[model samples]
Target chain A: AQSVTQPDIHITVSEGASLELRCNYSYGATPYLFWYVQSPGQGLQLLLKYFSGDTLVQGIKGFEAEFKRSQSSFNLRKPSVHWSDAAEYFCAVGGAYGNKLVFGAGTILRVKS
Target chain B: EAGVAQSPRYKIIEKRQSVAFWCNPISGHATLYWYQQILGQGPKLLIQFQNNGVVDDSQLPKDRFSAERLKGVDSTLKIQPAKLEDSAVYLCASSLDGGQGQETQYFGPGTRLLVL
Candidate 1:
């Protein structure tokens, strides 16, 4: 079974500061990775995804993630975060199980203006 | 295109009561999913439907939970004899395909359930 681990439970950053959220996964083979964000009382929105090709993947909302095969990590990053960027972020990985995604416990982001 | 739609934004029921949640997937989407998100945890897959037929429901606690998608477009999930631990946000999602590992799932604003 594939599982995801997010090391951070909560992260706080000042507005305009850079942000990085760490994610690691354990799967038998190369896995499909994704990043999702959830605002309060709102559903999750896709931040980005990494299937194969490029190691660096760009996503909506000025977000990006780098998939490192050697480390089994797909960490989400943003050059500068806004106050509105405060939300919960989740990291997920999918295996051969037909879209069954194993998600990590979310990391709550807090951006202060 | 419009995203997945879910109804009854919030529901509060006593323990052992029954509750149902409705979901309407995006038009033309062939796959629908139901997830349970506990506070401070990521969403857990409860059931999945490829059109009107179930694809995977191994994790579902069938003794208490049941779901159906009769028309292949809309779905409903019901929990009978709800427990306090069942309090969580129920999310609905839809994807364009059911193939293994390619499609992206779009989520709906979840319905919050509180059981006393």
Candidate 2:
């Protein structure tokens, strides 16, 4: 079964600090990876996606993710965290040409000033 | 250009009551999906439709839960005698063509359901 795992349930970081959210996936074959962010009382928005080619993919809102095939991970990173960055982040995986996506539990990011 | 649309931003009903939610996918999108997202958890796919036809509904609870996309554009999901566990945010998403590789799905604002 294909699945996504977000190890951290909640994380707090100081504003202007670097941030990294860990994600791991289990799939039988090459997986389509994605990172989505949701703000309070808002629908989820796509941050970035990794299908093939370059390991690093840039997304909206100044977010980026690196897909590590060997580790089966697609981790999201940000160089400078802002107060607006406090939100829930989810990692999702899908099979080739598969419309259905498997999302992780999600990580709640808290930014402290 | 508009994203997916859902109706009734919030609904509160007593347990054992019936409730229904509606969704309008993006214009020209051929694939529609309904998902259930419990608090503190990820969204779980309940049903999928491919242009008025059912594609994947294995995860949908047919006993008390039902959904349809008759015109292949707008869809509806209903729960009869709703249970407390059924309280969650119902999300609607759409893609141009699910058959294509790496199809990006755009989501709606979601309906928050509360079963008292």
Tens-digit lDDT track of model 1 for A1-113: 78999999999999999999999999998799999999999999999998889899999989999999999999999999999899999999997548888899999999888
| Alpha-carbon TM-score of each model against the true structure | 0.98, 0.98
lDDT of 1 at A98: 82
Model 1 Cα interface RMS deviation (Å): 1.2
Residue pairs clashing in model 1 are none
How well docked is model 2, in DockQ terms? 0.77
Task: Show the lowest summed lDDT stretch of 10 residues, model 2 chain B.
Answer: B97-106
**Where is model 1 more than 4 Å wrong at Cα?**
none
TM-score of 2: 0.98
Q: Interface-residue RMSD per candidate?
A: 1.2, 1.0
Off by over 4 Å in 2: none
lDDT (tens digit, per residue) of candidate 2 on B1-116:
89999998999999999999999999999999999999999999999899999989999999999999987899999999899999999999999989865888899999999999
RMSD of each candidate relative to the true structure: 0.8, 0.8
